[model samples]
Target: MDSAVSDAAVGVPPLAEPDEAPQPWQTDRTRAPVATKIVVAGGFGVGKTTLVTAVSEITPLQTEALMTEASEGTDDLTDTPDKTTTTVAMDYGRITLDDDLVLYVFGTPGQQRFWFMWDDLVRGAIGAVVLADTRRLKDCFPALDYFESCGLPYIVAVNHFEGSEQFDPEDVREALSIPAHIPVMIMDARRRISAIETLLALVAHALEETPEE
Candidate 1:
């Protein structure tokens, strides 16, 4: 991830198009809005940390805690039995694009109870990137439902993990019951360019929903 960004900064080959600002409806500063918030969302262990840490301008504050065996029966530890640590509170960071443009990113905790906190986290958030792991595609349903119920625009980025079968975006959307308008993409969160592309898609999708004056 670091390599990708550093290379891009130095004018090395870039996989995506040259970085450009999102289409601006207005260019005035006094009437311009402040920074936007973007929530990085996904099922447990779907690479939220990796994506955030990769692109964040500052050191990320991760609230990860070592998981105890006592949580076995209580928490859903079905496929991820070896998972020892979990983020208890949240992960946060800021990304500054220019003097006036800043983006705040917040990563939600993994447990089901944390769902209650999402309402606050998503307030005024421009959009969310729903990370999906093909191995546990069903696990992302709760996040999807939450965003859909709130009418929060979002894009789903299918995370690629080792030994996971690659599925077409259409098939995955069919299985997840996602609307066609929502952007569905494939990405490796560990790569900076890949993660940035996901955010680009999210911002583009969100801007499209804004009623143009």
Candidate 2:
């Protein structure tokens, strides 16, 4: 579905027209930067690391270790034969959206064994980006359910991998049984601009879900 139509269906406020003057809060420079926490979660080898690295301004901290015989039977390498490393803990990065706003991104380990660390990683997160792989769409379900149970708003971003069959956002949404209000979009995790756009969408969705003071 088109973004405009999706936004309307999901109750996301439309972006202000370009000619409109900036809001007082937008123009304010005296306020201290607000730090927001965001989670980048998905299944194994679904590009969570790439997304975090692409958008972060600071050096990202990654805990990936080389794959070994220990995971021969447990880890699925059929879809990702070239994947030699696995995240043992989490990946962290930071992005400054503007002078007044910053985002702390935490990428969760894809393996179920490391999922125990997610509660701590997402302790104060405002929202999440659940990266989806068309080839392994079911892998994202756990993350999606976790965020929902925690009352954390999130947007699903389908990562486009070379040679993977392209699926429409609506089809993905239906296949995943995603609600109408949740956004589903396509993205290239390796590209900085693409990752930024996905992050912006999550931020926007989080803002909309936030109750006004």
Candidate 3:
């Protein structure tokens, strides 16, 4: 056998590995997509995760944990009987609106106990989506109050659920006592088109509220 062949037979490894190109998010600042952060907030079992999963182009990160007896009194499962898990920390996902614009979505946990994380999640966020369920409209009050107190621009998205009563946007606004200038509309979080439209509405509202430089 030749000396080179003998060396190969002795399990010698290759001298080099091919270089891999950087992903769009990891490229230079000049070429990288401009990132815009947004928060998706709502009460428990209001479909925040579903919206993020449906619209994100990349795989989403979820910190869900199976429901156990530990949450017997703390987490309410009455409206979400079929729900087997809950978001413990937060949910993260990303969507690219265009080659130059990317949106980073952060979903806050619904339970009040987890609300401490909201401050951190909304640090650099341009705006927020307060998803509401007509069946339990009161559940979203905390999210609304927090955003308002923080002076963060946000739009209310009433997620459509089967068998749930449908209300006109004006009616919803009246019920929630949302300001007239704040956008309030219906959205089906599980549908991609609906989710995208909801997000766009929020972005538009945020832009309108921003002071011109």
Off by over 4 Å in 3: 1-29
Clashes of each: 0, 0, 0
**Cα RMSD, each candidate:** 5.8, 7.6, 12.9
Candidate 1's C-alpha runs over 4 A off are: 5-34, 76-78
Q: Write the per-residue lDDT of candidate 1 for residues 51-140, one digit (tens) a residue.
A: 888767667889888888767776676666667788776788666554456667888875686777888878889999999988889888
Which prediction has the highest lDDT against the true structure? Answer: 2
Q: Which candidate is the best by TM-score?
A: 3
* Positional deviation of residue 118's Cα in model 2 after best superposition, in angstroms: 0.7
| lDDT of candidates 1 onward, in order | 0.79, 0.87, 0.86
lDDT measured at residue 7 in model 2 versus the true structure, 0 to 100 = 47
TM-score for each predicted model, relative to the true structure: 0.82, 0.85, 0.86
Better of 1 and 3 by TM-score: 3
Candidate 3, 1-213: lDDT as tens digits: 453364356443212223634346566566867889999999999999999987776678999999999999888877788999999999998776655577889999999999999999999999999999998999999999999999999999999888888998899999999999999999889776678778889999999999999
